[model samples]
Target: MHVPDGFINAPVSVAAGAVAATAVAVSLRGARRELDERTAPLAGLVAAFIFAVQMLNFPVAAGTSGHLLGGALAAILVGPYTGVLCVSVVLLMQGILFADGGLTALGVNITNMAVVTVVVAYAVFRGLLRLLPAGRRSVTVAAFAGALLSVPGAAVMFTLFYALGGTTDVPIGKVFTAMTGVHVLIGVGEAVITAATVGAVIAVRPDLVHGARGLAVPLKLRVDGRLVDAPAAPAAPVPAAARSTRPLWISGLVTALVLAGFVSYYASSSPDGLEKVAADQGIDAKAREHAAADSPLADYSVKDVSDARLSGGLAGIIGVGGTVVVGTGVFWAVRRRRADDLTAAATAAPSAH
Candidate 1:
């Protein structure tokens, strides 16, 4: 949910911003391990894909809709640290360029939408995978369950945040019930999207899936007297260029363009889960104006464009292009920074070096 400005007070907003800053700082360091040549390329695509998928708000109830939160999918496809960066990139682009989420509430949105979902989803996913069979199918199954649960996890966190710093005096219990109930259905959609997407990618190129690494079960052989562990297969060769390739990423980006540029105009014209709940509970009374409400890109349409199809199509293309450029820049900078740090470290080494 893109929490607007007035939902939470100044103190809560500032506190959440600080938390987001700290988390991003930590993720920058952690991303080095997760963002090698292979994962870094996919990371940018993941961000772009999340942005595109979010544009298509699927109907969940009669008057409400929901879309991918994307934290779990990003984390599972890449890694947790890069996943954080990926969601943050999407949030940043949406806020600054599209005005989809509020600037003042950026920190809260990141913490709740990016951090909470990835952490919760990955933890549950890893646990489930551990308990299940170690196969591609099992991975897909675990991904489905993980995506199913992560949405409710985020709703719980959001409810807690509102309970703590809510601007209005609403019933805490009722809010929790409403948020969790709607999001549970939303989670089912998330699960299906996640499982199907992951399964498809792994089927094509399991090597590209960061979570699928090291999934090959070891070989067993019969020895002279008894069964014995066979030597592991030789580590596959890493084509210097192939390591960074991302066919799934290219496919995903193309699909995102098609969906957003052409398909999003037809998406349900209904309030999303959060908006519906807020309106029903009278919690939206305090909703503040977006800081960039006047931006040409706000409301997902181009300025002075009379044709509905033309305006919306241009907006979607702008959004998709902008998100891809911004996301790629952010991730590339992160990767460059890592490489620079390593080079400096290598240079600083003394006689042993």
Candidate 2:
């Protein structure tokens, strides 16, 4: 859930900001191991996808709806560190352009939604992968379970934050119960989406899936009444320039556009889990106005675009546009920085006279 301003006091927000900053720093370093030329471009696509899917809010309880938190999906498809960056970029775009999340509470939102979800989900995913059978099925199962757990993980994190800095006087126990219970239902939806998406990718290009990297376990063959694993074959080299990125990139971008531009218009207008709880528990009374409320792109409507379809279409286009620009910029910079370090190491080698 996107936390708006004023839900947490300034002191707590500052502390949350510090925590978020440290988390981002750690993720950046972790990403150096996660990212590569092939996967770097997918980072932006992942963010755009997350942004689009999040618009399709499905109804959960009577008046509450929930959308994709996207941490597990991103981590399973790409990597955990990059997953954090993906969702963070989406949140940034929404905060500045959609008036969705609060500017002052940006740190809190990033920490709760991006950092906590990605870290916890990936941790659980790795743990499960170790205990499960090593195969594509195992990867998919782990991804599903990770997605299911990540949503409640975020809810618990938010509950902990509220306990520290909630503006309302609601009972902490009640808040925990409501947040965790509703989020678990939301987590089911998250699991289905993550599994389906990860499975689809694994089918097409298992090589590209980071979580499925070591899935090529040799099949066992029985010969002369003895069982033996087949000898491993060396991978055929793929030319760097021949990498088929355009098709997946174009298809993903097209899907993201359609979802945000058209499908989102029909999404339920009911308040999401966080909003519902805030209202029910009297925590929303302190909700503050978004700083970008006056932006032309705010509220997912384009200024001077009268047709609902056209206005929303433009907003969605801008969102995808902004997300890609920001995400790619961030990832490319990180990638290049990594490259620069490698070059520096090569150059600093001892010279043989």
Candidate 3:
């Protein structure tokens, strides 16, 4: 929801910051297991894509709009730990660079948008995958269900946070109702986007999809009135250099640029679910101006750019470029660290023997 400054008191904001920090730390460790050679590069693409997609806000209720929170989409396409890092990176970039979210409220935004949504949605997705049929269709279905629930789950978390540290006086019940109600409608948009994206990836390269990793049906054969496991065939090995993600990466980057640089211009200008609820419930009364309000990229418009379309387009392009660079750097570092650790372990094991 991109909580702005002063929405939450200092004490609660700091506490949320601590919580966000802890979650990131844990996620970093968990991501070591999630990100390998094949998937590490996709992490940055996922973050940039989430950032671009989030700019395209769709109308939900009459005056309210919603965008992809991206927790479920990220988790389904990538792994949960990496998904947290992806959204966290996007939030960090938006706050510091574009002034979309407040600097002071970074922790609150991260906790609600990244931690809660990713945790809840991934859990729901995994549960559904277990119960449903093992196929690409089931993965798509789980992605939709997970994303549909994550939005309201985040709304509830925000309401709970407000109950503890809201800056204004508003009935908690009323706040909860409005937040949950609007977000539920918003969840539909999230579900559709998630399903479409997940389905597309499943069709092209299911191996790249983290959630779909183990979903492929195992080989079997019927012999002597009984079914038995088929003899496993050795897979043809491709060299690391030959397994280039350049094509997919270039395509994804181009798509992200198109969405942010042009499609976002047609997105609804209405206040999103969080903003609408805050204005209606008076939670936005104490909202402070963003620290980067005067920055060249503030409000998604380039400085001194007269043409609305061109200004917004330029800013969106810059944002996508910046997010991709920073996110790729972070994920690459993590991936290298993981690789180094494995190498060291393997070397040490020989000496131990």
Q: Count of backbone clashes for each model?
A: 0, 0, 0
Which model, 1 or 3, shows the larger lDDT?
3
Maximum-TM-score candidate? 3
Ranking by TM-score: 3, 2, 1
User: Positional deviation of 9 in candidate 3, in angstroms?
Assistant: 0.4
Local distance difference test values of all predictions, in order: 0.86, 0.88, 0.91
Where's the lowest-lDDT run of ten residues in candidate 2? 344-353
- Candidate 2 lDDT tens digits, 190-289: 8888899889888877877888887666778999999899877788998764477767888889998999988988888899999998899898888988
The residue pairs found clashing in candidate 1 are none
Q: What TM value does model 2 have?
A: 0.95
Q: Which candidate number has the best lDDT?
A: 3
Residue 215 CA error for candidate 2 (Å)?
1.3
Candidate 1 lDDT, 1-353, residue by residue in tens: 88887888888889899999999999988888778666676788888888888888999999999989999899899888888888998999889878887898899989988999899888888998889878999889888998899899889988988888889989999999999999999999999998988898898778877778878886779888878889777889877655546556677789988888889888888888888999999778888889899999888888889998788878887777777787777777888888999999888887564
Off by over 4 Å in 3: 237-242
Of 1 and 2, the candidate ranking higher by TM-score: 2
